[model samples]
Target chain A: MPYVTVKMLPGRTVEQKRALIEKVTDAVSETTNAPKENITVFIEEMDATHYGQAGVMHADKK
Target chain B: MPYVTVKMLPGRTVEQKRALIEKVTDAVSETTNAPKENITVFIEEMDATHYGQAGVMHADKK
Candidate 1:
C-alpha cells in the first residue's frame, strides 16, 4: 500500500490539486506497481507562518 | 531524515498541537538517534469527507 502525501504551501487552485494528485498517483503506481485504485494521495497545505527552513521560521525570516 | 506527519480530523487546540509535536519529536529522536533540533514534525488535518475506507468514503459511510 503506497500512501503518498504532498506537503506544500497553500494557494493552489482546485485544478492544480487535481493534476497533482493524478500525476503523483500515476508515478507512484508505475514505480511501486501498486494498482491505481489502491493508492491514496493526501494533500496537506501549510502556510508560511507554519513553515521553516535552515533553522529559521519562514514567518520570522520574512 | 525522518520527517513525521500526523494526519487527523481537526478540532484540537493549539496547545494540543504543541504537545503532539513535542512528544512525536521526542519519540522519533530517541528511536532514530536523531537530535531534537534535526527533527521536523508537521500536523495535517483532513475532514471526514476526504477520508475513505474499504471503497467507501467517510462522507458516504454515514
Candidate 2:
C-alpha cells in the first residue's frame, strides 16, 4: 500500500485535488504493481512559513 | 513550499522517480501558484507491512 502525502500551499479546487490524487495513485499503482484500492493519498496544505530551505523559510525563500 | 512525500512500495527506477517528482512539482506549482523551487517533494518507500487500515497492516489488508 502507498500512503502518498502531498504537502503544498493552500488554495486548490476540490476537483484539482481529486484529480491529483487519482493521477498520483495511478502512477504508483502502475509502477509498484499495487492495486489502486491499496493506495492512500493524503493532501496536506501548509503555510509557506512551515517550510524552510537553506535556513530560510519558504515564505522568505523566494 | 510544498513538501510532497510519496510513500509507496520499493522498486522504481531512478528515471521514474525523477519523473514523478517533476510532474508532481509542476502540478503543485500550477495549482498553488507556488514557485517550483519552493516545492520540496520527498519520496519515501515503505514496506507494505508498515501501513495499516481498518486495523489491518497493508501487507495483509489486500
lDDT tens digits by residue: candidate 1, B10-53:
77776566667667777887898988778776666789888988
DockQ of each: 0.11, 0.47
RMSD of each: 6.7, 3.4
Query: CA shift at A62, candidate 1, in angstroms?
Result: 3.6
Candidate 1 clashing pairs, residues 3+ apart or interchain: none
Model 1 has an lDDT value of: 0.75
Candidate 2 shows a clash count of 0
Model 1 DockQ (Cα-based): 0.11
TM-score of chain B of each: 0.86, 0.80
Which predicted model would earn the best TM-score?
A: 2
Which stretches of candidate 1 lie above 4 Å from their native place?
B2-62
Q: What is the per-residue lDDT of model 1 for residues A1-62, given as tens digits with 9 covering 90 to 100?
A: 69988889898999999999999999999998999999999997885544443333344545
Clashing pairs in 2: none
